[model samples]
Target: MHGHQIRRAAQVDRTELWSDVKPGSLYGALHRMQVEGVIEAVRTEQEGNRPARTIYALTSAGAAELIDHRDEALRDTKLRHDPVDLALQNVIDLGEDALRAIIVARRKALAEQLDAWLALRELAAPHIRGLEWTTFRHTELRLRTELAWHDELLDQLPKLMANQPTSMTTS
Candidate 1:
């Protein structure tokens, strides 16, 4: 595919699971991949009034490398770091009202995102394969987990606030 074609295909990728393919970065990424011998320019074609576009095809090495990377990622067991955990660790700095407000806002955002994924899934359900469907499901599951965590934190806020130190002490 050419850069424009690749970018067009990226538009349907709501998951953004691997990498966020931005329009501006597509050409640069294609160039780099071609230079690395993972992809090659197949041919240049012009469609009437349109400018010539170089088509690219992945090399055999690229396919092998992709499989290796995918397998390695699947084998990875380390938890991804989230900045929310850091903020929660220092939750003593925020008052109960402030923490509650943050959690509420977070829940709203997560709910909105979940709604978007559901809409997309519904729209694409007829066209998508099992793996693609699972991508949507995976995102839905994560969003639900985070929303539940927020609800639980809200429920525990009173006890958490009561246990917080009234003043900071020097060591």
Candidate 2:
């Protein structure tokens, strides 16, 4: 249910969803979850004489498992690399002006993400109560922290780009 809700809310496809889970492992995990009674196949519908598509929904047990998994993930210390990091890694190829443009683009994207997170937070607030509020609070804090980090990185880009070697010259 967690995966389905997330995918639906985010409007992303299965291929994109697989990126969040371990590579080459999502199908097996989904199958296991179904077998374990955590998730169940809700329905199947055929499309224009093609094979039927199966839609799954989370059972109560699945929701519990999702919460447990989320808690464990939040506790993990491993640093995850996002697309901005990947772009930064290859910045030299783009030159300073282009790199700055990329940073600007990233800032714009972060702003959009922050707005979406805020809306999601608001939507979640009414449903959450007592200690459950703590989870939403944590999510908001993390989003704020990431936005701040993005701003800081944007501020530092000019100086960093200036320090980068422009070219090699020989006489």
Candidate 3:
């Protein structure tokens, strides 16, 4: 479930999954999950002459695992990275305006995600009951926090970029 959500949310292709999961690798993690009866992949035929794609679905075991790890997953910070950090790391190579443009674009993308997250939360409202509300609430809080963070970053970017030199010369 986590793997699927990560792939879908990041809009990552199979090749990019390696970077997303690193260490044990996405394939290795998926295989391990399957072996442990967490998830099962169903083979589905694709259009044209292409091979079938494996669509993963969470098993009962998988749902239980997700529930068990929900708190840990929410608390884990080591697996995450801020794109702003990546951009700043390469700021010497990418001009301030260029990096600012990237931030604006990322902000737009995150806004779209927040919209989707809100829609999902709305849909889950009546459907989620009792203890499930705790999980849903956590998910909603995380999404809202992320949206707020993005807004804050976008707000602060201009001030941070103001003092930075925008041009570089080749020797």
Best-fitting candidate, scored by TM-score: 1
**Tens-digit per-residue lDDT, 31-67, candidate 3:** 8778999889865446588655566788998898778
Q: Each candidate: how many clashes?
A: 0, 1, 0
What is residue 137's positional error in candidate 1, in angstroms? Answer: 1.8
Q: Candidate 3: where are CA atoms >4 Å away?
A: 1-79, 165-171
Please rank every candidate by lDDT, starting with the best. Answer: 1, 2, 3
Each model's lDDT comes to 0.86, 0.69, 0.67
Candidate 1, superposed: residue stretches over 4 Å from native: 166-170
Give the lDDT of residue 143 in candidate 3.
65
Q: Show where candidate 2 strays beyond 4 Å.
A: 1-75, 167-171
**Cα lDDT of model 1 by residue, 1-171, tens digit:** 888887878777642467765678889988988999999999999999999999999899899988998899889999989999887877767789998999899999999999998988898889999687777788899999998998998899899889877666635
lDDT of candidate 1 vs native? 0.86
Show the lowest summed lDDT stretch of 10 residues, model 3. Answer: 10-19
TM-score of each: 0.90, 0.55, 0.49
lDDT of 3 at 144: 74
Candidate order by TM-score, highest to lowest?
A: 1, 2, 3
